[model samples]
Target: MKRVVFAVPGSLDTPTGGYAYDRRIVAELRQLGWDVECLNVGEGFPSPDKATQSAARSLLLKVPDGQPIVVDGLALGVLPDVAGEVASRHPLLGLVHHPLALEWGLSAERADALHRSEQAALALAREVVVTSPATAKLVASDYGVPAERITVARPGSDPAPRSSGSRNEVPHLLSVGAVVPRKGFEVLVAALATLVELPWRLTIVGDLTRDPNEAARLQASISQHKLTGRIAALGAVPSKRLAGLYDEADLFVLASHFEGYGMAYAEALSHGLPVIGTTAGAIPDTVPQEAGLLVAPGDAGELAGALRRVIADAELRRRLSDAASAAARTLPTWQQSAAIFATALEKLA
Candidate 1:
């Protein structure tokens, strides 16, 4: 059997999108009869302490010489030493969900540092894989990677289960994403504040990160607006429970400033829920116009208008829900994603 090693910064338990991507890819590849090995290089990564670096070096030394390897670009971009160790001896492919430098909320200095590290990692890989065409262009134009050397392979969503009458009692607007500035939760809250008289609720799901200042600011805004009762924060829900949330929600909204590929939007569509997303990053690629609505980023008024329109018009909501279900069915499955990835690896090998 062909052997493949996937090097990632965190395990499946990590809640970030990049970690989710690595977990899905590795599982899918294993189902395809490939011998897959997962190596977790710890949390601090690319900037590991001296002891962590020593451990990572030892881990890399154990990878079978000349075997094909796939590196999570988000993790590898921070750890050039790991990339250097594997590139010369193996067929190394970098799977980049999105360039770390492009993430929102970073200071200029941090963004530049991430950009430099990403470029260096890309330079070391024999092939690069991105999730969307937009990302492909970013890699080619910004990172100087040749277009031909990069492959666009999208992530897949789980099939919507048979409805078990799991819908919610009240009309609810749901947003699923980490509590970070880039997610634009503040915008969603601002939008919700506009419809204070309406009989509806808004739920924001996902764990709050280490940034206390952002969390405090959001909490203060909610308190200031007196939206405490109408809005609920349910952090880090399990996968099974999340599906129930999607089913119960009347509309799934993502007001993110940017996304490489909007996984939550796709998942919402899979559950036959209409989506409201910003026209940033690859959101336009995933959320079709007929499936839901799109507004400018950080435009709270427009977002509120869109939300109201979707909530008030039952016929429009039904139409969008049907369209979203159809669109979701067209998305590639994880098995298909694995096949595409395997083909790319074979060609590079």
Candidate 2:
């Protein structure tokens, strides 16, 4: 049996797009007969404390010589020394969702440090696998990784029954993602505030615990807009309940500042919900013009204008809904993504 070690920073169960991709890909690989060993290096990665750094260093150094290993880029990107040691003795593949340095809301110094460390770590890998072509290109151009050495395996979406959609006279808007600065929920709130005269409600489903300060500010924004009753921020919910939300929602919206793959937008398409997203990152790549309307990342006026147009015109909404469903039908499956991952690993081995 082919064997490989998959090293990641945090719990496999963390509720976010990147972690979910890791978990699903790992499970699918095992189902296809790979003996995949999961190693959970302690958290606080990309900015680890001394204890976390020591533990992660010790674990990577102990991997058997000549073994093939895949390192989650979140952890591998920051540990240049450990990655260098591992690469000298074993084949290493770096799985990158996005460059940590490109993430929104970071101190300039911190971003620069991450960019340097990640480049050093990625340079040690035999090859790199990214979740989107945009990321692959970014890694090549910005990180100095060779274009030929990077492979793009887009995130997969499962088949879902078309959403029944909202029956209410007022449309219900749904947004799914972590409530952090990168998500641009503050922008979403501001945009929605402008359209308050319209009949609609918003439900934000995401992890509020990831950034307490950001959450506090978002709460204040909601309060300032006096949208306390119309907008609800429900922290992360189970998959089943999320599916229910998708089914009940009339429109799916997320004003993310950036995305490596924009998995949520694809998932919304699978549910046959028209999407409203920003043009930043891979969003334009994933959300087609026919399937949804996209505005500039932080442009509140544009977002509000787009919302008003979509909500006022039922015929346009229906057309977009059909386009979204057609787009979803063409999305790659989890099994296919796993096969890609397996093939990439085999080439390295």
Give the whole-model CA lDDT for all candidates, comma-separated: 0.81, 0.92
Instruction: Give the per-residue lDDT of model 1 (tens digit) for 133-241.
Output: 8888889999988988898888877899522322444568888888878889899889989888676788888777634677777788889899999888777789888
317-343: candidate 2 lDDT, tens digit per residue: 889999999999888999999999888
Q: Highest TM-score among the candidates is held by which one?
A: 2
Best candidate according to lDDT: 2
TM-score list, all predictions: 0.93, 0.99
Off by over 4 Å in 2: none
lDDT of 2 at 178: 92
Give the residue spans of candidate 1 off by over 4 A. 45-54, 162-170, 210-212
What are the clashing pairs of model 2? none
